[model samples]
Target: MKAVQYQNFGGPEVLEVVDIPDPKMFADLVLVRIEAAALNPADLAFQSGAADPLVDSLFPVTPGWDLAGVVEQIGVATAGFQPGDEVIGFVRGQAMHYGTYAERISAEPRQLVRKPRNLSWAQAAGLPLAGLTAYQAIVHGLKVTAGDTVLVHGAAGGVGHLAVQIAIAQGARVLGTGSAASQAFIGSLGAIPVRYGDELVDEVLKIAPVGVDAVLDTAGRGSLSTTQALAAVGARVASITRSSTEYEGAIDVYARLDGDDLTRLVELAEEGKLTVHVDSAFPLGQAAEAQRVLAGGHVRGKIVLEIREEV
Candidate 1:
């Protein structure tokens, strides 16, 4: 199998595609022939060694987590999936290695979900990590409910855009923050678009009046700091980018691989309540270029690597 791997930590420059031996299947893991892989900011952080202190690294690391693929082989102990099943997964583990960047990956059953029939491979590939983060933050962390006014920072971004839609799906009135360029895109997701910067608080207040019922900050840059001023009394707050200690009451969320959670996202997508937008896609050989594009920032949605033409 051909895979993208980096022997040392650096920027996109460190990545290289090489022919590697196929991964061996463990008793409890399913082997997937990857069709697409999505790039995330964490992929950049992990490749740059910024996440070094938190996770151990295996040299020649294959950097990716979000994947959409077809099952090529099933483990003896894995029963839910069978050969030829189409699947999507967040393949993270205790260490940085054996990622989904390759043509094949062996994943635990709990990390895999049946890909939504309505989504293409690229869209499905982009759903796992970002979708999980947004779903967990808005639905679980903030507990957004019908009639509530929710505020989402970076509303047009990869995670933020999904967060906006997820909040709306939960029946919350959403106020999403983004740049002038994104206002239309933000509003299209069924949220009231609020511009970023000095007037953000005013913009949100103009719509919510008494302040938002919950705030989800997907864009860091001191976004959590505004929760005190933008949220209503007793409002919940969650941040995927900031630290819990950075803001007194905000919950700092890290996305986890949960089969149940991914399945719910798939249902949302199937029901047309959630959408995964792929801003761009590159062939697997261009993994490094894809990372650079994501690192450049301001991406409207997920960037994917098309591993197979049929995808």
Candidate 2:
């Protein structure tokens, strides 16, 4: 099998396309014939050694976490899946030993769910990590409800786009912050678009004078503090990008991608309540270029690597 891997972590240049032995399925896992995979900030963080502490425990790593593929073989103990079943999941943590930037991957049965029939491989490939992150942040962490006003930062990026939609689906009145360029796109997701700049707080105040019910900060910088300032008293606020810090009154949440949460995201995608946006894609061999695009950090949605020809 061919994979993009780095023997030593350094920069994106360290990632190389190489031929490696195909993965062997272990009991309670399934061997998937990789169709497509998506790039996450974690992938770049792992490749550039910025996430060294997180990667040290999972080394000689293939960088991707989200994958959409078909089951080519099933391990003896794996149930609810069989050869040729199309599935998608967050392959990290459970299949951390074998990353998604490969021709094949062996993932734990619990990590995957059937890919939505309505989506193409490229779209399905975009879902796992980002979709689950947004779902968990809004539906699980903040517990948003109808008529609640929710704020999302980086509202046009991969996770942010989905976060906006998911909040709307939950019946919350949504407001999203992005660059001036993404206003129309953010508006399409049913969110009132707020251009992020010096007057971000002013713009938000104009929209919700009483403050918002919840805020999900996808842009890690100092947006958490901004979210804190605009939050209602006892409001729920979470950051998928940054670690929690000393914030006076807001509830801080750290996004953790869990199997059960991924399952619910898959169900939502299948039910048309959720959507995954693919901003760009590269072939498996162009893993370096994929990392380059991801590093730019202004993508409207997910960047994917097409690992194999569509079935």
lDDT to native, each model: 0.90, 0.83
- Report residue 16 deviation for candidate 1 (angstroms): 0.6
Flag regions of model 1 displaced more than 4 Å: 309-311
Any residue pairs clashing in model 2, and if so which? Answer: none
Tell me, by lDDT, which candidate is best.
Answer: 1
Q: Which lDDT tens digits does candidate 2 get at residues 107-171?
A: 88877888988888889989887887888889888898999999998999998999998999899
Q: What does the lDDT read for residue 202 in candidate 1?
A: 82
lDDT score, candidate 1, position 57: 96
The superposed Cα distance between candidate 1 and the true structure at residue 150, in angstroms, equals 0.4
- Number of the predicted model whose TM-score against the real structure is largest: 1
**Candidate 2 residue 133 C-alpha distance from true site, Å:** 1.1
State how far residue 43 of model 1 sits from its true place (Å): 0.8
